[model samples]
Target: MAKDILHMTYENSLTFAQDLDRDDPLRHFRNKFHIPQLNDKDVIYFTGNSLGLQPKNTRVYIEEELEGWATLGVDGHFHSQKRPWFYYHKFSKEALAKIVGAKPSEVVSMNNLTVNLHLMMVSFYRPTSSRFKIMIEAGAFPSDQYAVESQIKFHGYNYEDALIEISPREGEYHLRTEDILSKIEENKDSLALVLFGGVQYYTGQLFDIGSITAAGHWAGAIVGFDLAHAAGNVPLNLHNDQVDFAAWCSYKYLNSGPGGVSGIFVHEKHGDAELPRFAGWWGHNESERFKMKKGFIPMSGADGWQLSNVNILSSAAHLAALEIYDEAGMEALRQKSIRLTGFMEYLLNGFNLGDDVLKIITPTDPAARGCQLSLLVSKNGKAIFEHLTRSGVVADWREPDVIRVAPVPLYNTFEDVYNFCEILKKVIF
Candidate 1:
């Protein structure tokens, strides 16, 4: 697509992204998605950390369910051999469990991301007047901040007194792990819960979930994560890490459609039906769900946390995306992610346009970040972002002055990274 192809794959070669793509075992997975095209050519898509590309099979999968709904209507809930709407959430259970490293019993596919977060907090954020503070990253996604604030206000506590927000140090873009642990210790006396994104959305910093969970427990506070940016993009062991609860959206790296059904993980220890959840029929025991009992007899594990029936259409889309994940597997995907993102980092560092061009604010250690690299642009940041978009690169531009590009492993090639860098260099100069 470049007029000067040499600069694209030659002058821009280092990690020799082309060779890396040739060697990638997961290279074939790229063919599974529908890459966005402009002027009869695919865009250099780097926005999987924001919204993933649609799978080619996604429509086929969705059509099956649509046909069932068209023919069977009400009967599709129980009689559809393809996938019963009655037990729709079951289809995603195993795949989601594998993605997040939890037992099948601990996961459920339901509602949207923010809805699941609020649902999870209802049972987990039990605050007493004595130990009432909740800890979170200072600049969390607006939905999370709003949820926490509303939940606190609902409990008759003021935000200033009840919310403990951890911020990055001066001249820094991400919070230090040691600082997070220290704050957990300092707030332990009055902290009721500790919650944060598994990966910081704007900064692309991957928090240490295991360490944070341990510290939160030691502090006598329950710990949870919002995995909007981390799920399916990184490897997680939610169960082994002893994270009390978590919720994630399927729209991003999970590649489910817009507003796709979300997933929740409640450690098996919280499996008791009497754990004070806001429940509904879909979360009732399978045999008794239709009994229409006077009281809610919750299903075991995470399903017990569901508040309503499965959002069937959205869940169907989720099932479609998860099938791909189940096939590629998170382990293989994560290995590719490290290299793909690393390739982007290598090219960014070598761009040589000087710091005035831009500086990556995302963590340097691959382990401390997901696929996203947040570039803090010091000059003409928005204009450069517009130029990249015009050049057929799909990335995110966060307000003020930051651009986040995630070279997704599932479909992005090393060649894509090379072209992106070449175009970026030309634009900056």
Candidate 2:
């Protein structure tokens, strides 16, 4: 499948980029999104890692829910024919299950990512005096770090003692799989949970979730992931990997609007486990939910983790974006993502920007990354980023130095990548 990319020669020319686009089966998918404009022209958007562009169908989907609410009033909970608000959360189940490689019953579109992460920790992060420590990558997204630390403190352990952060060796930008496994083994006796981001946001490294899960399980720890930068950006097999739990926000690669609904996956083996969880009426058995009874009988599978009913307006936007994923499919999107990102890498390397000027910090291996490439600028990084912005290239700049760019597969094109590189080269050189 990758033979073409492995052997193909790349040219730094508009015609070559156009030729790649002309042959791309997923090229038309870009039309489904509304590209942002800059100075009367469409901007070259490469910040899907920060926030995904608005899908063209988002308004249509949101309006449907508005119309239902306008006409059906309170009865919309049950009588709205198309998608009753009462069962709104279920609408995203099948599509999300396929995206995350979980059974329909094992996945749920629910609260925001951090909320779901806290909820999952409530159930899985049980700590004892002997096995009370949590292990995480050193630089996980801030929200995950905050959530994990708070969970530790809430469990009556000082985070300084209970949180074990695995750092890359000196002079490294990404963690080696062996180093991660070794850390897990070294802390096996004290590790209570092993949590990591599906992709390291700063470095854009796609962790080996399957291998990490195996190692964590071997260490007698529950394994979970925060898939914020990963969910729709890369193909995932959470269930087959035996991941205990995972959560992801929809605003990034999922292409839902900002603060869109988040999804959670719980391995089916935990579907019926008598675990402790913060329960609400929505998570109770559906038939008995409105009975207003004293006892809380949780529903089966991931649905039991729900704390409240789905947010319909935001979820509608999610459905619209997910419709695209359902159509484009992860496997096809990933194939294009590899070639598109590889093409960008090829173009950047052609610039001969020495490490003293610009260096790509992301892993060079295609399998070790998604579409995002983190460029570490040696000097004047912010000025270069601002220059690209002025030139109508939308990219992300992390604090201090790194510039992150992601050419999303569902909407970005080879031409977009080529054009951005051309703009970037002009600014840097």
Candidate 3:
């Protein structure tokens, strides 16, 4: 039997929002973004896990750069907009460092996701004859898998010999941290590196990076994270965690446009470490980069990782997004996220859609995940997904089973959650 129908009134929503907004330190942040529209109405968008809505300031930022390019030409590299292209990446470093909790010297914005992954692999994936295995979560993003497999082959090792995957236990939706640590211990002698997403893309499970790094170190292996789904959505103290290195794309939670420049974090400890890496002219010492020297003398810090002159348009989008993050602050954003996502969970459970019909696979513990909830629609995941799309609920569907909904706190509100729940109830009924 269905429970009582939950009638939502505008006043109830207003009251609930009033209380939440009263305590919401980041409530004012809603005005900072550009919400999308469908049929002249703003659809309830809950898919920041896939692509974040644009920031309203994005166009202004891009136009400034475009105007500078038109007015100053090559001179724009040194003197054009208030933010010079020559040092444009610098403006975002302080803000990016704060988001991932790293020193300014440790973070730099550069190429796209796959490209950055390949670059980091060049530096970190040193597989020896004896210790030649790399460990990653079983269901890693396909692009990451391709990059890792190609790297293994490039190093003259068979894929089977070079990769070790930690999978969920039978019948379990999530992996236990203990199990991951156990796997590290068992393969200690053979593993060269432990690399996995800071947050699993499909499951939204935030891996325990600190503990994972500790275990990998105990096993005499280097540890790193691909934080595409984790960065900006959760608090990641990469510096304090002391991980070897990490990378993340800015398009998702960071709210940069599609295919925006990505970021990399190289712990300050490795600032001067002589690691074999694929270098480019851009990585050369700044004062001498234009001198056309015979040999590569890398810049002193993470900036040394750059493989090319910065893409100003992409970097401009990131700069625009970063300004919002700096103003709102990650802690303040995360506070609203907890309540927004919690409210989503509350509404989802209240649907009383039988467990056999649909189930949330993301971990229930707040500490173990970010803003996303991956719902496994057991009956007709694709059809339900189509219904959602047609109904103007912009959620995304993963193959075979999941529909990911992320109520990003930067712009989402209690009303969005309530409206989404109402739509979901109608879809199920």
Please say which candidate is ahead in TM-score: 2 or 3. Answer: 2
Number of clashes recorded per candidate? 0, 0, 0
Tell me how far the alpha carbon of residue 225 in candidate 1 is from the true structure, in angstroms, after superposition.
0.3
Q: How many clashing residue pairs, candidate 3?
A: 0
TM-score of 1: 0.96
Q: For candidate 3, what is the lDDT?
A: 0.87
Q: Which ten residues in a row have the lowest lDDT in candidate 1?
A: 1-10
lDDT (10s digit) by residue, model 3, range 1-429: 011112222233546755766776777788888778889888888888888889999999999999999999999999984988888778899999999989999999999888888888888888889998999999899878999999899999999978999899999888999999999999999999899999999999999999999999999998989999999999999999999899999999999999989999999998778988889988888899888979999988798888899999989989999999898888777766777777778778777878799889999877788999999999878988899888778998898888999999998888787877777878878
lDDT of 1 at 351: 68
lDDT of 3 at 353: 78
Better of 2 and 3 by lDDT: 2
The estimated TM-scores of all candidates read 0.96, 0.99, 0.95
Give candidate 3 regions above 4 Å deviation: 1-23
Q: What is residue 181's positional error in candidate 1, in angstroms?
A: 0.5
| Model 3 lowest lDDT segment of ten | 1-10
